[model samples]
Target: MRALTGHPLRPVTEMSPQRVLLVNLACMGAPALLIIQGVLQHGKVDWFAAGLGCITLFALVALRMFDLVSQVHDKARQLDAVAHIDALTALPNRRAWDLELSRRIAAARRHGSPVVVAILDLDHFKKYNDEHGHQGGDNLLSSAAAAWRGQLRPEDLLARYGGEEFGAIFDQSKLADADRIIERLQAVNPLGQTFSAGAAQWNGSETAEELLARADVALYAAKAAGRNRVYVSSIR
Candidate 1:
């Protein structure tokens, strides 16, 4: 209904108009020709011709049906992707981040691996927005998101947690590894701006929410100490 979210202006159907016409022609034209042939042959039914026509009709119908099903499946997948993505930056949004954190925590507990969570806030983001227009701020944010996303490992997750803030989940990583990755993200970002981050490796007994809260506390500490640094939570 919404043109499959990001894919706007796409044709209503995945199949082209010409292809649709071709399918319809094969479905109807072959049967009509066979019937005409039977009539011309003194109504003695051209069994061979009719059989071929029937097969062609069924095959065309099956092809069209499969294409429709595939289109539906693709559309559904696009919708799901849209739901989890930030419209501006095309990065995973807060909802996706939350789910990923829970998933990673569960997996880490099972495998006796570490799950590191971090919260990053752009330094003096308000000043940047005030100096540059909203559009400029948005461009900066998107660029930063892209750059940070590139720094993540296959086992890591980076998501926009709303307005100038991002969340990261490092599966099978400890606090030290998280710090290194965050430093890397800050270093590579094209915005030429710094961010303050707070991170904590998941403790065996804590929930994802508790883990995030600890990271948040550490993040605020980083802001209090200096603008461009990372603080690791000391609580377990």
Candidate 2:
């Protein structure tokens, strides 16, 4: 329609309020010429009517165009938010936690500070599901995630690692710090439950996966030792 009317069409991204003004001015150019010609060459169109019609059309088009742009911006923000959030627990997901861990580890290595990784598994979670049903277990896990989230610092990263398992990355801390965190988590009961956790400190050379694996081993040891305590890796 714009091309047929002798107005140049630009791509949507190239559009701006100034460009919209230029396009409207360009459209008005034709009607202004036509109105002048009608006065000089005898009436073919009315000058006042043509100018008013052109201004009104331009106003409506510009309004619609800006409305569409605002909608696109809002949708982009919504998608970015969904990417970082875990739908089930409403906590940070694994990907978000990995990014946090990377930043913390970089700062710790530079400043000779400690960062701790703790991997948590619900004690006898499979047996709990078998005895209490899957829905009951899910309610417990959700309650547990909420409990741990409350214990975290603003810089801490807590995520659902998998079925009956969760993890955290704590900045400026050691493996021993997990004892207090574990105690806080165990004190409350939606189902009279407890967690087994393994913790290990970042050693400068270890990747996040390696750190998590060491924590997992400690978690196994804690589970073996009794199912309600925190264990620092004996190897590290």
Candidate 3:
């Protein structure tokens, strides 16, 4: 009755380990004080002796449970982080980009708005890697992706499209808008790090696959044009 009237102390079942340890220490220490007072006054030690063992057991159990829960939470967070990032470049990976692309494409198609697809392939990338070594190639790819991402709108979709290639999907964008973006991306990337890009605005005449193939042809044309430039499918 006295304990209930003072205030309701919350249960320790959900409390953190540090808090639980402090509370248990306080509880056990109080009993020791009471026992010392009782024994000194009347030669009795039952209160302290009885409560000490139970408090010790409870603290051990709480600490064990806290460690287990913390380990599990840490593992879950690591897995979630890995799911969205590319293993190679640590960029938001192809899987994450694909999901965003499908969503944007559906929205654009429904609203009768324009969307642009740009495919970029590094010019002479194999030769560059062969001459510079694998580590240099990895560094170049990482730098290129970062530069491209920096030039994109917050809503733009960018993904590494296999070896030495990348894909970008820009919704509600025109050819001129895509051209500006490509220029900015190229400008920030390293010198001699040139890419051929093919861009196409959605025309309702082609599936995504067909549209991408057309973009690839334009990319090849851009490469044939001496590289380091953007070409639209309409121009091709």
Which candidate has the highest TM-score of all?
Answer: 1
What is the C-alpha local distance difference test score of candidate 2? Answer: 0.77
User: What TM-score do all the candidates reach, one by one?
Assistant: 0.77, 0.74, 0.65
Report how far residue 149 has shifted in candidate 1, in Å: 3.6
- lDDT tens digits by residue: candidate 2, 1-236: 11122332233465779988987796777577787878887877666666777787688779977977776665555556667777777776777777877888788978988888888889888999999898888888889888887877777778877788888887887666756766676786457888888888888778878887888888899998888888887435
Better of 1 and 2 by lDDT: 1
- Regions of candidate 2 where Cα sits further than 4 Å from its true position: 1-59, 234-236
Poorest stretch of ten by lDDT in candidate 1: 1-10
- Provide the overall lDDT of each model, using Cα atoms, as 2-decimal numbers: 0.84, 0.77, 0.77
User: If the candidates were sorted by their TM-score against the true structure, best first, what order would they fall in?
Assistant: 1, 2, 3
Model 3 C-alpha lDDT per residue in residues 1-236, reported as the tens digit of each score: 12223343333345689988987786577567767768787966566455776677678768877976775665556555567667676666667667766666678768988888999888888988999999889888988887778889987778877788888998788889998998888888764678889998878545677777788888989998899889998733
Which portions of model 3 miss their true places by more than 4 Å? 1-81
Taking the tens digit of each residue's C-alpha lDDT, what string does model 1 give over 81-148? 78898899887899989888888788888888878889999999889999998988998898998888
Ranking by lDDT: 1, 3, 2
Cα displacement (angstroms), candidate 3, residue 137, comes to 0.5
**Per-candidate count of clashing residue pairs (backbone under 3 Å):** 0, 1, 0
